[model samples]
Target: MHTRYGSINREMLIKRSPGWRWIDWEELSHYRDLLYFLTIRGIRARYAQSVMGVSWAIIQPLATTLIFTVVFGNFAKLSSDGAPYLLFSFLAILPWTYFSSTITDASVSLVQNSLLITKVYFPRMFIPLASALGKWLDFSIGLLVLVVLLFYFKAAPGWELIFLPILLIILFIVSVALGLLFSAMSVQYRDVKHAMPFIIQLLMYLAPVVYSTHTIPLAWQKWYVLNPMVGVVEGFRAIFLHHPMPWNWITTGCGVSIVLFILSAAYFRRMERGFADMA
Candidate 1:
């Protein structure tokens, strides 16, 4: 009886020792319910006290697209790769908004939840994961608006429509990758919070959100696709406008996202060892 009791005690100790793992799938699954509630709470809390509520999601991209249409499309007379300038900018804005919002919220998630982080033993990664996942609601609302614009323009997608899912997956990977890295750094150094906005603003221009990638000179085109969102935005336009797929850009984005995800996950896990102490 004592031997059996000792064996049970050992198993309990082993189960409880969830050390800093890079990506512990089993441990995350064990706490899946926590992740679910955290994601739901983030979604509700996001719009609960807002004046416009969920409409803010649609308004942001729509407003930005209108400004770009006026300035870049009309004034500058930029190329839209043959698609309507309004539709072109809106397509890029959808993913850019989602990517920006996710990382922005996630960058402060750890600090915001310091109380819980210090007191809880669950996976710390869940905090940022919840932030990243919550933005899907906003993305879906924007996607609905995109559908309406597609009809208004009478555009039709072809077999290339199948590539959309892959592009979306890469977009998600890029967002979460940066989200994890920024959140981890934000915990130890508050400067990440202040610098994040400028970083995001810089990235927006870098990724061709306000202009067409075609406008990028042939000399710079190879280096330009290094920004993962280049592929994502151009892929969206290709699908909606029935243009040929930008295979090189898309593949480069996939490779870059994978590398970033691996590095960010490792860095996040390493940094999390001191999170409770830092919090």
Candidate 2:
């Protein structure tokens, strides 16, 4: 329709445009309720049709810890900085599992919700963030298991435990940042689905979940901290097991993670406009 001034309406005009648009933080805030609903829906769907349900969360990490203790701790005789190998490994696994699962689910979130993407207009970031929340349920279950394990081992965490919550916050941010990057890429490249498992598996080994960082040579220690999870896994052990704080590693890793987060957020916003069409 023409404007009252007799010019064509700007809104009705079509022009071929390319390149990214700035992220609209206000629009995302306006959709906060929708994000909450999606998050709740995701959490519910996770436990809805399972036989063991939430118990699997406890079982998976518990079993992994046992296996690592036997193979790496007993057979390989890996050191855990004087703490029991089982305790050290389980603490590391808790955060590792949460981070790994969140990234995996968030990566494919958009494609999995293609029906919604194709038919609706909403903040696309909610899809991946919602999936990440679903994985948090698993983290909660694992955390409970960790408490029980500590009780069984008769190991009370010391004052260093105070740092755990801060470490966890950093872990969550790193996961979400990496998740957002992969989620955006997955929209354009379906191969990410096939490759994600191998990538995660490789990351698991690269992380110090099964072994102590103390085993690494002094020369390699600084370089090792560059892997973001190095800080997270080691930080967990240092806090819960009362090992010396890996301050240099934690500081450097946190800095790297923040940079990654900013870059990922910018890239995600830049590519987000094409998501609906790509999905």
lDDT of each: 0.91, 0.85
Residue pairs whose backbone atoms clash in candidate 2: none
Candidate 2: stretches off by over 4 Å: 1-22
| Cα lDDT of model 2 by residue, 35-93, tens digit | 88998888778778999978888888889889999999999988888888899889889
Taking all chains together, the TM-score of candidate 2 against the true structure is 0.90
lDDT of 1 by residue, 50-70 (tens): 889999999999999999999
lDDT of 1: 0.91
**In model 2, how large is the Cα lDDT of residue 273?**
76
lDDT of 1 at 245: 90
